[model samples]
Target: MCGRFALFTPIPQLTNKVGAVMSERDIGPRYNVAPGTWIASIRQASEDSAPTLEEMWWGFRPSWAKGKGTQPINARVETVATNNFFKSAFAKHRCLVLADGWYEWIKNTSPKQPHYLCRQDREPLYFAAIYAKREDGRLGCAILTEPARGSSIDVHDRMPLILNDDSLESWLAPDLTDKETIRNLVGHIDADLIEHWPVSTAVNKPSEGQGDELINPL
Candidate 1:
């Protein structure tokens, strides 16, 4: 699951690359982003226009969410198509969560290592995500997770559903009525797009903002 990630690209550069209009001008560097914080995401507001990149809360709590809690950070790809909390958003509110890389914890005899995972070619990785607007008008996005691919699986059971430029069209433009089409797009992340390496575990805590400590090797 994509519990942590980073986006250091300037908002204008990201807007052009993702074919999105910038919603804010000051969305600067985020090297140690965590869940439950505002993030950058791209979603088409209407059929005719390009996508919009805006700051979104990194948790999804649809109107149907019960009781008193914030929301969920990541949605399991295995059951999102049918799960009560995510199905509707999966069909209708899919988005591309923009990230330069993500940090995953690896178990070891020593201290748990934070592995930074990203595209091998040094491009931003867009994770297949779903979003929903809450009663108070907060937009939330949740990264989808599937069985690991590439070398990262040795460290974790699940990895973010990452998309390259090839699959970007299908992922960002899905037929809401066609479940099969959506499922196909969801499952076909290119394994060749990713690479991983160990780093410091300063990212274990969310309170720490973007800092060199998070990316520095121990």
Candidate 2:
């Protein structure tokens, strides 16, 4: 699960790459984004319009849940289409959770080492996510995760459903609502295009080590 991530890219560069207009001009760099915090996401207002960048809560809480239970930060891809909690959102409220890189733990080690993973070229990572309107009328989102593949399996058994530039349009196409079609858009991410390395474990605590140095190779 993508419990933590970083989005240090400037708002202008990020908007340019994703083809989104920024909702706010001053979205500062976030080096250690955690669940429950507001994060940037891309979504279309309608099928014919361009997508826009907006800030949304990280965890997803269904409207009927009334904020009384545990809100999940990640949804399993295997059951997302059928799960009662996520099905409706998966069908119509799909979104792109923006990030530059994500953190994963190597559990096989004595003290699980945290690793930062990102595209080889350092482009922003657009994670497949579904959002829901909360009881309080606020929007919340959850990242989609699938079984790990290739080298990523060594760090964790599951990884966020990342989308490439080619797949971005299809995944964000507002008119596409068929479950099977949506699932098919989640094509294989070339593992070779990804890079990872151990980082300081200071990221383990969400409130501390939020600087760029936290993601530096250890």
TM-score of each: 0.88, 0.93
Clashing pairs in 2: none
Per-residue lDDT for 45-156 in model 1, tens only?
5567788887788888876564357688989888998997788888778888887888888866356668888777876777888888876677888898889887778678
Residue by residue across 1-218, what tens digits does model 2's lDDT show?
88999998877776676588778456888889999899999887678789899888999998888778888999999999899999988888888988899999988675668999888888788899999888888799999998887677878989898887777777778888899987777564677777889998788887886899988999
Please, what is the whole-model Cα lDDT of each candidate in the order they appear? 0.77, 0.86
Candidate 2 Cα lDDT to native:
0.86
Top-lDDT candidate index: 2
**Root-mean-square deviation per candidate:** 2.2, 1.6
- Which stretches of model 1 miss by more than 4 angstroms? 66-70, 108-110, 185-189
